[model samples]
Target: MSNLATKKLSGLLLKQLGPHHLSSTSAFHTSISNATAENSKPMITGLFRTFILELRNHSTLSSDELMKPVQTSSHSAQGKSEDQKDQKAISSYWGIAPKKLTKEDGSAWRWNCFMPWDCYKADISIDVKKHHKPSNFMDKFAYWTVQTLKYPTYLFFQRRHVSHVLLLETVAAVPGMVGGMLLHCKSLRRFEHSGGWIKALLEEAENERMHLLTFIEVARPKLYERALIFAVQGMFFNAYFLTYIASPKLAHRIVGYLEEEAVNGYTEFLKDLENGTIENIPAPAIAIDYWCLSPDSTLRDVVTVVRADEAHHRDLNHYASDIQCQGLELKEAPAPLGYH
Candidate 1:
């Protein structure tokens, strides 16, 4: 074919495929079909053979060059470098990259909700039966307040242990959060430290939330029960916030009594489990991990650890109230971090 004729044919083919498809190998076939419709059979045959030769020449280099492994390795390395750059960019954009964690057995950590450092063996030896006797008017009022709240809850749930504890945990989780948030703001406003009280209270809140998560695995709540939680949590959070603002002593005292009630309730739960009134099922995985229980641990073990935790919370809150009652700021005494 003449050089001018070849250039004309190439232009026609490029125009048929459009600029986007010009570089695509598949476009050649479509171009050939279009050309056949426009030209005589003899001219079309010649153009097809010319295009095939051009494609073959462009597709391959010298035999020695095609056999080289270095090219393949270099291309793969370049691709890997680009992928690493993309990953780094994404990580930088987010400003947080998850750390890879392992268990003591060197197995991959399975939970994103909590880290291994958060796991601990519950101090089951803690005295669960310990009670704070109401020594004054405020103490008496706090005790009666908890008692008043406790009875109606008992009447409502009766022996529904899972549902009862689930609701209990939801309420239990709130006070710490409210106390922590208030203390955090107070510390910031005063330009003073919280004597670690903020961290301690937040930790307590997290621990109580973990209890809720553990129970949820055992028994999902019904719609009505969840609705009740919504109403109760909203009321309790606001009421406790105001109480904490008015008097941290009375607020802590109320939480101390509430913890005492929680311990008592768990004791009852254990009794039922022991007597076969409630099935002593294997512990939920979340409970086992959180409490650092044995793989074969049962629900009885879970309740036992939870009861111990309540006992510790009771002591800590009562101690806080005691410090405040003596006209000392909570910051004067170091918080019992990791009390449980």
Candidate 2:
């Protein structure tokens, strides 16, 4: 008895499953105007639907539930409300929203480098060429550190600015990673967040390392200079670690001054390139790839981007110092995670 009834129902379904039957649904509509008209029409015809349901073998489910699969494509716009409810449930089941953007709204990732690309390209506006007098003991110490490093660079690597940059970047990359690591440990120990400082500092470290990598391709430093880089990096890393542990504010101020000097150095380098004192050769392939530069990028273009990055770093360090000066922690304010 059950087999006979199942065969009858199967034959009925087959009869209704023709191409013409599909035409009765809206999915294969050929014209936009007709599709729109079909979409606007009401789906429910109570009398007709009831009459069709009475012919079915089992009438346990409603008409809407029975037709759900076929209507899915046509009802996409209408399904948004249903999706919202499901999305809310899913978001609660997970910790965060699935579709949330990782970075700020405007910025996105660069393809080759996998670094954040600033959509609103901010220009370097700070006049780093101007010198500031030391106001307090901390300021004086910061000033002294920057001045102490300047003369050796000038006397030893004269006209070898690319090599100078390679050295600077090697040292510059250390502070951010150290700071980020320390902050990460502190946060974990205290069960507190560092706002966004850990990510921001790590990103800065990565950016500075990229600068080092780019310049290495262009500069090709001698054996002695590479040895000098090793010496300077080892000494500086230990000194900075201790200094940061003693007073983070003073350490940040020192970095700010260091970045200011970097900006000045790059400015002079740019001037030489412009005045034909130094040849503006094609940019390093790594620089072109990392910065998303044009195929015809030059040394000047690479310098321009590096200068802008230094200016941004200068501003960030100064801001961190200011936050510390006010007797507030860096966690009190949000860090600019994707400023680069």
Candidate 3:
């Protein structure tokens, strides 16, 4: 990856993290209220200052803070921050499932899943329609994962009003995940069937609905009063993800791809449920200047849910394909790729 790409990925990973390790703030009304309540500058002004490249409608964070120095395994094992100490109990309030045994430390869903996530190489990087007769399903599965993470970095950053292109993509994509599922169902009958993969998909879809509400609820004022930019970018992402279903081979890959995502989502949900209530992380110093809520909530929770649902969708797709691909063994094109 280029330096910029590397930095963005780092920021994405770090956005959900805390000031230290165990810790990670609030809605716009809360910030404005706080700002009005105290004309005196915050004690930790630097904490609120923009870090890396600022997106429109928001202040930027420091590159160092944004990138968070990709940690070495040893560093991760030893370096625990002061904030991490306070976060242990607070994390439990979020209700994330499978809380750690320590019981007194922070409980982040991603934190708990770090090891397993590292091991889970959800690679979906193959050209399905063009490769094999009935095409070995394995290649399509791997491709789905890869296609999911790849990004058009520049388009992601392009400016439009207050949002950088990427944030808009996120805002739009959450609703898209649910819509795509509804449209992809085999028969209207399948939608009514509430069992196995269908049941899981519904749960995931509900979560996605919740996620969109959460994003808007957390950041309502700006979106309601100011221009909506990130929301648009999200639409771009939404459309891109949906395009995959057009190709059966590609759809097959996505079905598996989504399953892995669903697994990650549920895994995080388990972490969150165990923890209790997850307090919103503070917006970057820069973002607070304009936007109120942090993007991490939308990014982590929504995407995780979509991924988890996708995981189930993959299963349904596979089952559906079992019969479709029986006789006509056609080579398939690759699946549409992009990170949720």
Candidate 4:
């Protein structure tokens, strides 16, 4: 990391967290001063470990890189100063300082820090037909279980991808939350650390919740659909909770397949939008703000970003399953923190 980028990241840490949370002395902290026997806080660590690396890794970027300069009005000299003030306010809201590094292209310089990977695009159009099929009987069982529960939505909702996403997200968010909670309890009971898996799983749950929120604004589901969400969430929550307790590996594998199906569904949604089967309406404000989409972004753009997010989730859950296959716990490996 460059000296300027390091400084910017350190500043970001100072603003969002107390010194007891993350000291400015190092790129990462192993522990904090707020630790207590009754409520020992877990160490802050994860895939964010690579956040402050050299510029060779261009795919992942910091929050600073997402920032664009506010265009100054050409009518008056005061316009430039006004833009600067407004920029400061925006920066403040994000817990960023006023001192910013700008690139020649008029965008903020990419800093070495942890930020959401919303900008990462995946090659979703790849031919995954072979990969989609089961390789064995056990794989077949998992595949069939997912497909059985999944295909019925098409008959019920038709091409209502927006509402489908809302329902899917509600169920998808459950596993992470359940996993995190169980890990938290396990850590407390065994007096063993989770190696950051707790936080990582919790973050995944929160991310899925945000996806549901964004879709709710876009779809505005009917009352029956809303009722279905409640029924699905309640049943899926308990089912996933037990599944995780019985075999975390199988649970993760299930989610991995679920996310793969989600990616496929979103791709179909994108195709329908492009084919004029679905209206390319303006993106919901929440989606625009959360994904940092352009002002003129439409539903297609939102789906693209959401699909990217689902792809990342699919990778993560499959990786978790792989760890279990190796007779290791998720705590044995680092979890991708801001993986879209």
Task: Pick the TM-score winner.
Answer: 1
**Per-residue CA lDDT of candidate 2, range 1-340, in tens?**
2444434543465366544333333432222122222433222233235336444613465545545555565587678768877666455644765343333435443344444442234355655555445788988989898999888988887877888898889999998988898889989999999999999989889888888888877868789988999999999999999998889989889988998888888998999899999899999866766676777989999899888888888878888887998899999999998766
Give candidate 4 misplaced runs (Cα > 4 Å).
Answer: 1-137
For all candidates in order, the CA lDDT equals 0.86, 0.75, 0.38, 0.71
Instruction: Order the candidate numbers by TM-score, best to worst.
Output: 1, 2, 4, 3
Best by lDDT: 1
Better of 1 and 2 by TM-score: 1
User: lDDT tens string, model 4, 1-340?
Assistant: 3445444554575566554333222434432333233333122232134233322233454434434344456645687667777664445555866456553447654532223343334344543332444565655667778889987887887788888888889888898899999999999998988878888788788778878877777768889988999999999999988988988888888888888888888889999999999999999866655666677999898888878777877778878887996899888898787665
Model 2: ten consecutive residues of lowest lDDT? 28-37
Whole-model lDDT, candidate 4?
Answer: 0.71
Residue 284, candidate 1: C-alpha displacement in angstroms: 1.3
Candidate 1 per-residue C-alpha lDDT over 68-99 given as tens digits, one digit per residue, 9 for 90 to 100? 34448789899898888877533655578777
Backbone collision count in every prediction? 0, 0, 75, 0
- CA RMSD of all predictions: 10.0, 14.1, 28.5, 21.9
| Candidate with the larger TM-score of 2 and 3 | 2
Report the lDDT of model 1 for residue 29. Answer: 53
Tens digits of lDDT, candidate 3, 1-340: 3445433544564465434331212322243233422332441142234222133222345434644556888777666664576565545555875644321124332323122222222232322222222356655554644355433422443222122212422432343344345434643644443223333334334433433433453344344323434444455455545644454445444445444443443455445534544443433322221122234433334333334334434454454345345643221212222221
What lDDT does model 1 reach?
Answer: 0.86
